[model samples]
Target: MTCSRMQSVVIPRHFDYRVLKCKVSSISVWNHLSVHRSLAMNVRRLEVLDERAAGSGMGTGDQTKEMVPGGISSTETDLEDTDDELGMHEKHEQYLLDALSKMSHLESFAWSCNHSPISIDLLWPMLLKCHTLREVEINDNLVFSPVTNDESEGDSPNVAVAHELRAVALKSNKHVYGSAKHPDFTRVKGMLNSCPNLESLNIAYTQPRSLPHAHLSADDLFLFGRWPNLTSLTLTNLRCSPSTGLDAASSFLFAHLNLEILHLDMSPGTATWYNKLVFPPNCLPRLRELKAHRDLVSSLLACPSDAPRPLEIIKGVRLTQATDLQQSADAFFFNLRRHGVNVKRVELTSWHEMEDIRRLIESTPKLTWLDLGKKGNGNHHDRLGGSGASSSGAAAKSSSSSSSSHFSVVNANEWAILLSAAPELTTFHGVKFFYEVSLQAQASIANAANLPLYANGSTGNSNSGTGPAPGATAHVNLNLMNLSMTDRSRIRKNDETASMLAWKCTKLRRVDHWEDGGGKVVVIIRDCGDGKEKDKVAPRWEIRRVKQ
Candidate 1:
């Protein structure tokens, strides 16, 4: 194709000039945009994320130099190489600003490169000038605090606010989550003032516990006026003063009845701290996805049985230990069984037992994704002995049950049984699952699954019988960090067992083996045959899309 034709076809209306490497030729979007100056007018969304310098190759006769106005051959522009990096950066910043001027029709803009010489404050007027712009996001990547309102405003004339903006997200440096240091609140307030009717807002601000700010509390989240269009709110790394009481955030939630998605990260305190903050029941009728602390899960799921929540995904982070879950475990699960009936995905960093997993699968029949937590140690024996086991027979039964139910790690047969309970589950993360380690156990599970045994007593599948199509592929990513080589070797992925699992749980696609020390290993079921011999060698791509 001709260069002009290629530009017309390849360039998208939504452009992301984000690069992780400093070697994107000129290390700026303008040099690349210079290649297609006409295409800039068509851009609707532009994201310049993690922008960096081009390093040593700047003065060379590179493609970027040829595409951009001032090349190495141009006598008008004098730029140094690695010896004078600052001069090159200054030249590129000018080029970047020139490119931004061309994108007059841009509707969405995001700037996340804190290291760039360009200040986000400088970009505000340029972006707000775009009459079509509606959404904006800024991520702080700098070492210092953000510019204050007065500092940001400087001597620039009063620019008209973007009343048409529908979404705004101002994020702080994410590395420090539980700290007082946050992005400049004054600048954030000024930005919020510009857009009053936002449909979505994400502001992560935390302050010292002593001098509590209402911005972290119920003062309409510091908005100039109510935002009736707000449907999604993500507030993280927040610590409201205890003196402010539990109603600080909940009161805000009560007012926003139209909210569909909410992700709140409060101070990681005790269960009592979590339990004290009640999730006002019979509210947020439109809530679809939720992520909050674990102790408050029961209350969040405490919506009326008749008015069950339509939550498709629910994620919880445990504040305390396993003993917290030991309280009314059955009833806690019963609530999940009720309100979570419509749920398709469950991710809990809270403690879980075999019975807990079993109760979960049996409850959420529509479940396709399940993530058990890594917080609890296996103390099943202790729980059994202390729960008042009277007779030896009961003890023996509890002993057998604990082996499958209580162990932090479980065997393949036990996993197969648990999987059998939820046939629809395709993706599973968390917990240690080992297959092909115990031959006797494998044989027993194979027998129970009614899998056909060959002459050698091997259960390797030959037919696709109502299974994954021929040459089908699945992707798994598991990280097994900080495990002894012996334990790691034991978890060696056996493809045959993975196929057996695929046959047992026919829809199974991906299994993520996540270890506590932040390791992952993914196992795929591949090359499943159609049981036909005529075209054994021909390759065919059979793709299937599962509904989420």
Candidate 2:
């Protein structure tokens, strides 16, 4: 690449680096990465996961590196040929340290292991070298320090603490259903002590479960000093310590005045436990996004905040009881209206009727993305993008009116008519897009766009509204529709949907098509004509799959 090209090369802040054992003369990922020294200097986040990288694992063979003195190597060698991996691990650690030391702009560093938890002694040199590093994440059973016998107090080694670091995420070695048996308090405390400038803390399981039972507790949190900079907090799988545990946690949350985002997915009877959850006066003044179990959503938002904190996202838990889809949606809309919250993105788990869905849209008109909760949900999506007989005239309804007994099968034209009120909407989910091109559907879309419909894109009389709108264009902004039915998500025929709505919704950029074995295919609606040829300018459609 040329110097100009190299200068303009955009390096992603988040980088996932994996070390693989290759047979090409011990050439490592580091060897290739080191060539672009500029890339290393600008890295903000990095992950190292390999068979024997750093503290991931140290082999247990009798072949120790021939020592000069105090088991120190005068000259470091690569680990490809060494089975005496303890001494061999030093070389890998040296390679890691050398690379980390050069990342002056690095902010976040993540490390993982494939097996058991190990001592993080190997990470000390790395952490010490990264001056601007603000975050550290480890998936290994990476312990802080060994525990002692004393019940009240115990002796744990004085580990190096990065006062400049702002975030630390610790995940279990295992990622199955029992992801969080929960690490010990002493170990958590040791970690807390190591990174005292705590701002954002995320200790949650990596998977989904009905309930998560953890040994970690609220009392353990009180062991550390209050972080004044703490803004975002996520606690997924933990039981209340006891009678006073949840109370202490409540107090802890209330005390943090700067908190903005909070996800309290407390488990093992998650929802019912937080029914009585309370917030102190004027607490969470800057709070914006709140996610928790559905049962706890109402109670959580019931306690009014002194400030007018406009929440942009509220993700209540997935609904296990399908019977209350209507009641549940009504309650959610009530909160949005009562709290005066205007959200941009919504993920409605389970399902709800069309009327309930309409109420939600009216409540949050600024919605840019809406997930109708996935298909195979309580109310299944139309495999044929079902437009029932009642929904046939759905396109004729006013943008502000409710449906006329339409049960299912909302076509592209109906969606265009319904979502026309929210011009900012782009990515829509939950509903299937089974809209096949037809005269009625085309006419409806054209009406929604404030343009006259045309038959077969041919210019005709401008007297009737159904005739071509002489030089008019679509006013619609809807684009990037996502269907929940994976089997029927793909839009066929060079996007017959895009072509039909082209006169009405000109800005429709891309739609998602998911084939079970294939990755995501994006429909690109590009304007290939020049401004000089305004009359000739038309949208060109292209399809490409996003690499997984």
Q: Could you give candidate 2's per-residue lDDT for residues 36-142 as a string of tens digits? A: 46655756656555334432124242121110112112222343557665745554555555665666677777666433232354465467556787888766544
lDDT of candidate 1 over 1-548, digit per residue (tens)? 36976675554432332211222124344644544566566666665544342333453433212222222232223322445767666766666666667777777876656455555566676777777788888765331254656775583556567778888887655333222344334445556666767889887654435434423332335333357778998876554544444565566666787888988766554335566665666677788988876546667787553466668888864423356456745556777777777888888665435666677778789889877654354343322211121322211222112233232333444576677778788777664443212333233323433423211122233343432233321111111223233322333334334545655675666664322222434444444345464223221111123332
What clash pairs does model 2 have? 386-409, 387-409
Question: Candidates' TM-scores?
Answer: 0.63, 0.61
* CA deviation > 4 Å runs, candidate 1: 1-45, 49-99, 116-118, 141-149, 152-159, 174-184, 204-225, 269-273, 304-307, 319-321, 328-331, 350-352, 373-410, 432-496, 499-507, 513-548
Tell me the TM-score of model 1.
0.63
Each candidate's number of clashing pairs is 9, 2
**Candidate 2: C-alpha RMSD after superposition:** 11.5
User: Residue 461 of candidate 1: its Cα lDDT?
Assistant: 33
lDDT of 2 at 9: 42
lDDT of 2 at 283: 62
